[model samples]
Target chain A: MPQCSNCQFQNMPGTTHCGRCGASLLLATALIDVHPPRATRWSKTWRKSRFWHIWHSLNHLSADLARRVDVSYPSSWPSILAAVRLIVPGWPQLAGSKVNLGRFLLGGYLSCGLLAAVCYGTTIGSFFIAVAITIHSIGLYDVAQSSSKVRAVRISRILLGCGLIGLFLYLPLFNLVPQYAAPFAIRVNREPLRVGDVLLSNRNAYVWARPRVGDIVLYELNPVRVPAFEQGRNAVLNLAGQRVDRVLAVPGQSIVCDGRTLTVDGQPSPHRPLNLTFSSLQVSLIVPPDHYFIIPSGERIDGLLPNNENIVRTLSLIPITQIEGRVYWRNYPWSRMGRIR
Target chain B: MARFRKLELGKGLPGDSNPDGPSGNEQAGCLELAVEQRRCGNYENALRLYSRALEDDKSLVTGWLGQVQMLIMLDESVEAELWSRKALELFPGNGDLLAGRAQAFRRMGDKGQALLLSDGALKSAGQSAYRWMVRGELMIVIGQETHLHCFDKAVQIDQDWLVPLEIALIYRDLGAPSRALGRIRRTVELAPDRYYAWFVQGQVERDLGLEAAAIKSWRHCLELCHGHVDAERELAQLEAGGWSVGRVWRRLFGNR
Candidate 1:
């Protein structure tokens, strides 16, 4: 069935005009299949091929691994290998007949190399090191191949690659690895973090030191500790994931958030007061042993907290056991990136 | 069937600022494609197409509306406000633009400004269903008791499934899952194949603790629109068997 482009009315198949509106349905054909199902066998293969294309662009072995079964078992291994070579480095004579994989591969290699270098230079040290090593090996192999290119051209390419690679590797060698690693990179999806911004948390920063008031920490939410009512209502409350929040108080402290003002241990705290969009939540408790009270970094924290009283109570004082790491830096959006206070 | 509703769309709010129907050229085609993309939740692509459409025909009110609506969905209320004000400059006293500006103000937490703008929008809205829906949403945000009546008016203007869907969502947010469920049931009856209706039904059922029913509704939603993200997430949570008391205790007591 086609949907009316003008009125959005779903019309019967083969109808010249919308049943509800008299608009011609000719243009409605494009709107009929908005989201095609991806579970089909053809789509699965297409997805796999797309993944292979990315891996191939990076010159990673994963692409080769993906093709090994078809390559190794094929009766035309020699022809296939030759085809692969020609497809990647299509001669100018075959420009119209063949895909210019050579241009694509070169572009992909340089971009991926730059990305991996930046990733390593920032905080993703281990993963980028492995990627850097793999790409360098591929570069060295290209330089070694006599059939590939002129000696001068290969040497210059390798030198450029080596220079960029060395710059990235220098940080790790000098004990200058970034203080935090951003394993959770989706903080930009929320407020305070703009698109292209990345959050970096130090897993060991709080291990030796005590987390104090005003520190943003990553903590795990234990659903079981959440009251049964909340778990039944919204299952995400208990889902295991590292969440970032500002620590409000520690053990033996009394805290109060009156929707407008927040006071801790009889002193007014310096922080934005909660927005009273929902029912005002009031909590005053002696922080129990091994518990830390943390609040999310948003003006309106109502939807951020679970609805059940027991869950809210449990969340109000996060057990030290659930504390994962301390968020310390905004690593991306270079213009605004800096140490998070 | 009554499922087919007479729609005087893109005309109700702000008195049809675009007196010219459309250039009926490539720009109109682009606008149509942009609307299709927006409806499908392909926001980034829709934005690009909307901009293209606007570049060719700046007077196209729907293009401006789509841009403002997409900005709101992206949680960029500041940008939404800027764009709405720009549209208002071109089409002054346009009700849709005024309502869209109200939405941006509401999101920015300025309830007073939002209410004033929304009230002004209602005066010029005439019978625009989308404008009435926006007014109803603002009413809910301001905690007004007449929000439901606004939603009713929206539905009364045009019996589109979207009006009911919007009403159901508001009810769900107000902690009245039963009411949401009732409205969503009517939406499903009106548009049985609409994935969003089933998805909202599943949500209301989940809130009501009807796990089995929720799962059934979500499964149907996925069947209708395969790989729907929300439905997929809901199904995964249900399949994971939820949290147990012992497991929670272990997490709370275990030292990392």
Candidate 2:
């Protein structure tokens, strides 16, 4: 007869599932007693063997360690090992014999982590990373609870284990997300911001401080309609993307430019366009409120719309809300790694 | 030591034989000796004997059942459950093996499963004192008043002194020392020479606060089983007047 591990039902011979409880009998194995029987001559001889001596020694070591740790019944070295196995999220759950939940958590954590990695630096990636962290945290809590039957021991273990995990794993990722601090790789060559130089941007910089002249800023470009010749008819093309540039003028300042030389409030400005080359031009305007004059990076606005004042105004003036972050450090290309000027 | 003896309740004495005694055969003698060892509270020895008997004769259902019962007595409920399943494989639908598995489940705290298995045991082919006793234990676990009727049915099925002794042991464990005293006294009357009975009787008397009767019972138990460590310990504790406030509180209302 095969016994159902779930309900302990004794089914007839050769039964695949339990007749009473319908639990599958194929995977059910009988529980074996680990305690040795009373010592007899045969048993004594067996105990004297090298295998028995090692096993006995290991048991004693685990018991001693458990006692030293104040972990009572069910908190042997195996349970502690299970708690430590939280590195893989669901490994501890599997060690604690929660097979179904362990598999689900492991699958979820791995899948979410893989997706987050594949879609790194996007909103979707951050969402997946958050989900993965939540799953890992749940696994940690589960392992801690299963580590001991004592309430105080379980709670203490949960706090200590979760605290360490949060410190090492969650905290760094939490700080990185939500525009706290973000890494950006410079793809185009712009002086001081060369290609392959990775910059760290403090997204929270302008939260309390105002954007000042000479500060490198990361800002989103609003879509603009540009005339395009398509299929022999004039078509409107939408152009939008992000750009990193230096602030040349602040709000309420008067900016005057004659092609190359730039002046702000009747004085020559120290800031130069980071992406655009010096050219002959004539422009004079008062910086609008809540807007900063930023040099467009490598954009030939005059050539795109010759003599179009609207294009120059739209390209030069950036709103305060558009300022995404302050570039603080150039982190990549080992030789040039330092705080951004 | 007293706790161990309270469970035994002289139910393991050699003379209080199992009603399902071994059949007259070559391996019967080994099984009979195993039964005697089990009666004498030497469950490990009894288990080894049963294994030896099974090695010689695999068809002997009693040998398998005895192994399972001994494991349960030794508080190896997991081994009992496994062994019972293995035995059931050989003798499928055997009522006694089902009851043994039920007892294992009960000890393992699976009361619902235990009740389910016990019901199957009762409806199976053969009826035995062990099966009724398991049902009675299940009843007691559920706080049913009909537990006594179930135990009485077990006693009626098997006239051995072991039946009442085991019933008294169960009663005492469930914190009904008053009810246990009657059954234990009957056990002592039936088996006067069994020192384990007097030991259990003393434990029940002590639980009821009958210090004088408990002392007398322990003395008699020591005389029958000379140098019995548990009996001597009980007498020593009594002589030293070691009843503490906590012990008194436990005696009065700990069961509740």
Candidate 3:
């Protein structure tokens, strides 16, 4: 069965058009992952790889190490009680909500994973990891208890349900969707955009209007092509794309960077050069229609502008078509979670 | 250093410099084969052969250069820079390495370092057209007025069609569509059947506001390379904008 790209409705094999919407089904047929099965694809690929062998090897090694260490469980009851004791703060709220224990445990697990993912790129990794592990232990205790209704459900089904929920949460969180509205982590500590600031980009926002000057946008490029320190510090958070930048000039705008300041249409604009050198000082150009001059916010210049513009477009200016979306909002670090512009 | 010295004397490393074994010429032979593969658009195979060549003789400068060149073509600039730096550690001050690193830096968006390295490359040992091309790009980055001279020098050194195509792109960025069109015309003359030439020609024409001509060029490009994404997109955009009244209405009161 081929899934329609438009409506996502399953269509008959060899169908040229979608049955629901009459849209072309070519893209769906050509790309099998358009509507991938929940877990079948993973199991199939796992069977092909040496995953089981590696897993068994690790399992045996861990078992041998456990035997050598002679570390006992030290009463599973104490561990369970300790885990429950940790979650006592939330028990009152859980009791008042009338939600099932399974649902509550699932919520705790999700919130922890989300927090860990959101903080993974930051300096406080250990804090998030600890919180997540504690929550995970609590969830495990809930499942192990015979009195809890969650323990009555099959472990495999519970795991599958939790896995699916996690996957759904991750898709939008990681901007994996073709049309995604998500948060972006600011890697460069520039004037306007500080490191660890989370910005929200609506990838589908520019469907009608052209991007204007002064619009801070989340555009993409080949990260391997963008210049940065080789020590992996200042490494792009998104391996597939460049960092966030502001649009200084839109299509058909005459712009010049004379190594000191930017001039848009003969007047000196407030935007100043951040990175420049003697051998590569100035650049003046008319922004071609369907293209935009996107530069990181600060006194520094993007390395692509002065030299490699011809080789890679995203170095200085980017095609409007390549823009993921406008960075309309910032939604993280609590202190800066509002309209970005 | 002694290992490198022994290798230089053609007397060490299995499958490397040992004259009585697989000879140092194999590295050169592998590089040539990789270059041929790259020319034929077999980039992955070229990369693999370049890597194999480098493993056999780590001191092979051309092998490193070829590998980095292929990586750059594949848009793997980070890997290219890493590889270039590794080669530079072993063969510091080599002109090609300096120039290659300069290119990697330029792509990485470090123009200041790129310019300094490009200057060093030009002074130290770069006589090749590729070296001159890198200089031209660096010159443009530095706000030099006569950057075109560097490109002209590159063309003078080697009349490969790629140099002109790059030069035309520079001119296009500089907002001189006429000059870009002139250079791209030369590119088309040099390689008539090349779809990329036609595609670029269409872009130049579009910039010049010659929509019909742009459409014709893009159509020619599509005929050459069927389903070319850029050409197809450009064609669709042109067709969409053809209805002036509807476009004006949409602009006046939102398409939605």
Candidate 4:
């Protein structure tokens, strides 16, 4: 039954306009929302067709379209573009520009999977490659069916650019990208150290042992309680706090900072050659099992600051188990970025 | 050492224990499915669908109570209690919803609060056998001198109660086996069709050393109450030929 959007009234399903208020009955006739809330804005482009769902999926759920729990309705083109975003990811934001990002992922995945399978001789990789090929073929078909270059350019640019980027990512200088990515930190002097900076640990760096003394290490400080039922399960703990410091003490070692001097394992730590290591304040810290002690360059010179503003000349030994994948490069603010030594 | 697992009660959900589901566009159709699921005791899947439907639209109250019942089944009282509050925000004067919340509070060891909520629900004419049963449970956990009163209330509210007969047996702690038997017999006189009556009758007969009669009554309860876990366990223990008068006495009174 068709209902009027303005007044609470129902009529025959075929009715296009309200009998009394003359309000557009198209939403009811086409969309079948017989009891639409009067407060919400009504869409005028209602058509009672079998393909109504396709239109709804495209427009209502588009990533490019902003969700308004108020007086707004999605336009036809945006809706179509929205649904295309899901099937061809990155399409909504990248649709108009001359870049086609679509070409790389689907084809790149297949190529990578095939190469992995050939190199590793794993059937698991082959199956993954097959799924990639299938998606790529679907993407290829979609591109060919596109009526205009503007509609397809985003997919094409993505392919060429991504393939080029992927091909060069593991190479030499290009690896120095993370320094530009996260721009919160700044480096001073010869120490590849930056204050107000948080570094992502290179998990792969310490494959055999922990990060050594004077080597800045990144570790998560988030406190997450793992239930007894899930003690050893892989948990993606979010970082609660962040600090970058060089290793000062490891397991079976102790540290006591006293009046601008530091002691590791009951002896003064080596601080002369590294001019930046000037932090000295008296506080004894024990290095627990499977943990690392990292001391920062700032602390190496300025003793422990009460407010935690002065970088510690000494930091706790980071646990080997508390490691995440290494972030080796930065790539934000093109002017001041380099390898996070 | 096996740590004593806590006792749980009531499947208090919104989509459950209600004729109409939460409000939605397809409410009428969805509610009918919920009703069918409830009758068939396919409460788990019915609950999942109700919650999913609610997620699609929080305005839908059908899944709210359905979630309550599912939580009761899952032994999740805290979550069920939270959901009851959500359901109440929509249906202010809803008696069933109030009773469901009361059951959640009871599960969390807040018997005093649970009793008050149950009383409120009953005053609002949520006077079904289920509400009365909840009241009976509140009395047992809060204080058990009201066993007869609660059992009678449950039976009076719904004459054919399978629950009252079972609740009466908790009187073994009061050192009155005969009184428990009397309560069970009364339950049978009122609700002959209920499997609980027959099962309680079997236990009484077993207490009185009538093993053959006990077996007969228990088997009959099993016939009526398919997948009755407690009854099945009892029957299996008896069938193993290890059960005797001495064993039964020790088993029932060992802890006491």
lDDT of 1 by residue, B1-256 (tens): 5565675454332112445432446567767777666544466667766766665455456787878876765555656776787666555666777888998777655666778888888786344877787788777776786777888888999887867876786577557788688888988899888787888899889999887788789989999999999899987886566786644664588621
True contacts kept of 1: 0.00
How displaced is residue A72 in candidate 3, in Å? 56
Kept native contacts, as fractions per model, are 0.00, 0.00, 0.00, 0.00
The TM-score of predicted model 1 comes to 0.37
Best candidate, DockQ-wise?
2
Candidate 2 per-residue C-alpha lDDT over A1-341 given as tens digits, one digit per residue, 9 for 90 to 100: 76655446788898877676454565422232322233245644655478865765674466456556655645343344444466688876653436569889999999999887655555576799889989988887787776578888778877787788888767876776647658787676656577777677889989999899999899977667767667899777665677788899999999988777899999998788665573444678899999999866564344454355676678778999999999876656657767776
lDDT head-to-head 1 vs 4, winner: 1
Which candidate leads in lDDT?
2
Taking the tens digit of each residue's C-alpha lDDT, what string does model 1 give over A15-38?
A: 876676464655322222111111
| Backbone collisions counted per model | 2, 7, 18, 69
Q: Which residue segments of model 2 deviate by more than 4 Å? A: A1-341, B1-27, B238-256
What lDDT, from 0 to 1, does candidate 3 have? 0.64
Off by over 4 Å in 3: A1-341, B1-60, B70-78, B169-179, B223-233, B240-256
Estimated TM-score for each candidate: 0.37, 0.42, 0.36, 0.33
Off by over 4 Å in 4: A1-341, B1-74, B144-147, B162-185, B194-216, B223-233, B241-256
Question: Per-residue lDDT of A1-341 in model 3, one digit per residue for the tens?
Answer: 98754345799999877676564655312311111012144543653367744764564455455544455644422232333323332342242222256356557656766775555434464477567656644554444343234544545434543464346544454556425446678776765678878777777778878787777777775443344554656643223455576778878889877666779999877653222221233577788888888654442334534665553344566887778787777656767667775
By TM-score, is 1 or 4 better?
A: 1
Docking class of 3: incorrect
